[model samples]
Target: MSYSRRKFIQQSSRGVAGIGLLGTSALGVSLGAGSGHTEIEPGAFNFGVASGDPRQDRVIIWSHFQPAGQHSTPVQWQVALDEGMMDVVAEGIFVTTEARGNTIKVDVSGLLPGTTYFYQFRVEQAFSEVGRTRTAPEGDIDLARFAVISCSSYAHGYFNVYRILSERDDLDGVLHLGDYIYEYGQDEYDERSLRNERTLTPTHELISLTDYRRRYALYRLDADLQAVHRQHPFITVWDDHEFANDAFQDGAENHNEGEGEWRDRKAAARQAYFEWMPIRENRAGGISRTLRYGDLLELIMLDTRIEGRVAQPGGVDRQSEAQDFNRTLMGFEQEAWLQQQLSGTTARWKVIGQQVMMAQRYYIKLPDLFGGGASLWLDSWDGYAATRDRLLGHIRDHGIDNVVVLTGDVHSSFAADLSDNPYDANNYDRNSGIGSLAVEFVTPSITSPGFPPVLAETGAATIMAASPHIKYAELRQHGFILLTLNRDEARADWFYVADVLKRSTQYRLACSFLTRDKENRLVSV
Candidate 1:
C-alpha cells in the first residue's frame, strides 16, 4: 500500500498547536496550533516537497506554491529532528513568484553531519506534507548505501519502483542518473498511456517554459514519486529525455526547425529543471559536480547529455569518424575537471554517477560480400573512442583503485569490466580479472520499455558471449540498483520489480557483483 502524506500529517498533528514566528530559533517549539491543513489544497504546494544536493552542513529543500490571483507569495519553512514539528532546528521564510514557476527552494545550512532531519512548509493557513532528509557525513565512515535509478516515463507505466524504494528505511540517499522527466507529447512515446491511465499534461512536446513546468508538475503529482522525495534526499543529473531525444550541447535530434530556436527551447528546459529540481545551480548552469560521503566514497556526477556533447556521427563511417581527437562527450573543460577530481580525491572509493554506459559494446556480423565487421553503438562511449581511451588509460596509468561507474539510460542492466582492450588475449584475461582498469554497472529503467523478452534474454547472452569483459546483462527487467560501498569492496545488487504496468511492490534480487579493493575486475557474489 502507498503511504500518503495525508496520513502522515494526521498522525503527527496530535503534538502541534499553532503557527509560530517567521525566524524561529532552535527552540524546539511545536508549530501549527490550529492550522488543520491535513490534505492537499488546489492552489498550495500541490506538487509536494523534496530535498537534495546534500553536503556535510547543508541540503536543498524544494516545493511549488501557486495561490490564485497572486503573482508572488511568502512561504515559511522549518526543519526539525522528529516527524512532529516540535524539535525545531532551523526555520526561514522564502518568497516564490510567477517568474520562477512559483517554485520554492531553500538551502538549509548549519546542519550537523550525517543527521536526519524532518521538515515542513506553511503559507498562511495551508501546510505542506512533512519531508525527511539527511546530510552527508564527514571524516571516516564504514558503509553507505544508495539507490541508483533513472528513466521514469509517466506514459509508460505506474511508479511502482519509486513507491517500493520509498518504503525502505536504510538508504542514505538516491542517485538519480538522469531522465527525471520526458519531453514527449501524448502518445508520442508510449502506446499504453491511456490504458495505464497516465497521460501527459500539456499534450504536446515540451518547447516553451510553461510546457516544461507543466510536464514536471505532472510527474511530481504521482504519490509514489512524492513519497520517495519525501523520504530520502536525491542527487540528480539530467539525461537526453529531460530535454529531448539525443540532445547534445546546442540542439537535439527530436527538435526540428518547426519548433522555434533550439537555444530558446534549451533555456526553457534548463530553467524549468532548476525550478522543479532541488539541486544547487552554478553560475554557468553546469550540472556536473562532486558529492563526497566522508572518507568512504566520492561521487563525481558528469553531464554526458547536454552540457558539452558534440553531435554523434552518422551513416556507416560513423565509427571511424568518432575516433577524431576533436570530438568530445564531456567537453574539454569537464574532462580536465574530472581528471583533477579523480587524481586528487582521498576517499576510499571513486564512484562515477552519470548517464550512458562506459564500456565498449559491439555487435558482430558474419563475413559477406561487403566484408562484414562489428558495428559500434555511437550513442554511448563507443562514439567517443579516444575520449574513453583517455579516461580509462588515466585510471590504468595512475593506478586508481576501486573505480566504479554507475550508469543509466539504456533501459537495461549490465555488469562489465572497463579495459583498454578486452579483445587482446596477451594483456587481458577474461577469467582472472587482469588488465582491467575499472568496472561499470548499468541500471535498468523504471518504466521505459526495452527489447521483447525472447530477444532481451538471448541478445544478452550473445553480447556477453562476444564481449568477454561484460560478465552480466539483463535487458528484460525494469528496476534500480542498490550500491553499497565500504572499506573492503563495493558491491552492486540488481533488484527487479514484478510489473510496471500495475501498482505492486513485489520485487526480487536478480543478481549481485562486487569488485574487491585494488582489483578492477568483477566477481559474482
Candidate 2:
C-alpha cells in the first residue's frame, strides 16, 4: 500500500476491504445480483453498472465480474429504496478476486438525507444494470443539482453525450471533469475510428495493467456510457487523458524513452483509476478533497493532473515567467489546501471541480494577418501564472463571493469572469471594477473534438472579441453542463449534441448562464 498517485485508494492495487467494511453505519447491500452467489458462474455480471462518491450517508457501488473459476467470485449486493425491487435497504457479499481485477466496489452506508437510491449486482443468473444514486445534502439543504461533464474520447465519436445524459431524471450528481478514458491507439481516430461499433479493446495503446484493464472494458461497453453510469452519481476527476497527454508530476507529453516507465505508466493509470472509479480515498490528502452541498454547495475537487503538475509552461514561452514565483498548478500543498477550502467555506456555492481553464486565456487575433499575444494554452490556467495569481489572490483576499470554477480540459466551451485584470481590449466594460473575483463554467465534450464547425465558430468569435472576462464561448460543441445551485442563483445550461458522429444523436439547448448568489457576474441567461 505504499503507492500513492495522490490517493483514491489504489492500496497497491487492491483487496482492501476493511475501512471497517464501510463501517460506522453501512445499512444496505441486498436487492439481488446473485443467482449463484458463494460460488457464482453464469455470465458473471457484464461490465455495466456504477454509483459514485456521494455522502451524507454513503455511496460507491460498481461492478465487473467474469470468473468461471480460478476461485473467488461470490458477489451479491442490493440497496433499494424501490425501483420495484421492493424496499430492501441493504445486503452484502463480496468476493470477485484475481487480486481485485474482477472488480466490484460496495461501500454503501446508512442511507437517508436528501435521499434517492436503487442498486443492484449479482453473479449467477446475471443482474447488474440498476444504479441510480443520490444522497449528499445533510441538513436544511437548499438545492445542489449537477451534471457537468468533460472530455470523453472513445475513438473520437458517438457517446451521444452519454445518451443525452441518460435521459436525465433531474440530476443531483455527475461532475466528471476528465478525459474519462482515452489512452489512444486503435485506428487512432481517422475514419472516426471506423465509425464506432463499440471498437477499441487494446487495439493498441494503453500500456499495460493488462492494457489498462482492456481499455476499461472497452469503455464499459458504452450503452451510452452504461446509461450515464446507469443514471446519476459520478463526481470524478482525472484530466490529462486519465494519465498521459500533457501529464506532469514528472513527465508526459505522451511519455518517452519508449514508455516502459513513466512511473510504470503512472502506476498503471493510478491502478486502473482506483479499480474503476467511485472515488473515495484520501489517505492523507492529495486527491484534493472537499464536498458538502447542504447549505447550498462546496465540492472543491482537484489534483491538477498528477497532484503537483510541473511540465507545461512552454509553448513558445506561453507566459514566460521563468520560475515565476515557482510555477505550480496546485502544488504548494494543493495551494495551501485550496486556500483552506476557499477560506473555510460557508457554502452558498464554492464548487471548483478542477482540471483546466480557470479563465484568463488570451492571445486572439489572426484577422488582418497575424499577431495574438502569447497565452493560447501551455496546458492552461494560462500556464500557471503564479498559480493563477495565488488563486485569484485567495478569492480577492477572502472576500470570496459565490466563486464557481468547474472547468474541463478544453474541448471548447467557456464562460469566464474570474479576474486579475489584464486582457483589456480597450476596456470592453467588464464593469471597470478591475478584477471580479470568480466565476467560470467551462464544461463541454463528453464526445470530445472541438473547433471544426468554422474553426469552432471562428475561434469563438476571437475569444469573445478579445476576452473582457469572456462571457461565453462554444467553438463547436458536444454536450453536458446542467449545474443549478440555489439559495439565490447559480445557473448554467449549455447542453448540445447535434451529432457525436451519429448514433441518432440529438440533444440541444446551446446556452444559458447566470451568477448572482454572491454575484461575481456573468449573465447570458
Q: lDDT tens string, model 1, 246-355? A: 89988888999899999899998999899999999899998999989999999999998887899887877675666667889989889889888999999989999999
What are the RMSD figures for all models against the true structure? 7.8, 19.9
Q: After superposition, which runs of candidate 1 have C-alpha atoms over 4 Å from their true positions?
A: 1-40, 190-197, 364-376
TM-score of each prediction? 0.90, 0.36
lDDT of each candidate versus the true structure: 0.83, 0.72
Model 2 Cα lDDT, one tens digit per residue, 347-381: 87888898888776667533222332356676887
Error of 2 at 379 (Å): 0.9
Cand. 2 Cα-lDDT: 0.72
Error in Å for residue 265 of model 1: 0.6
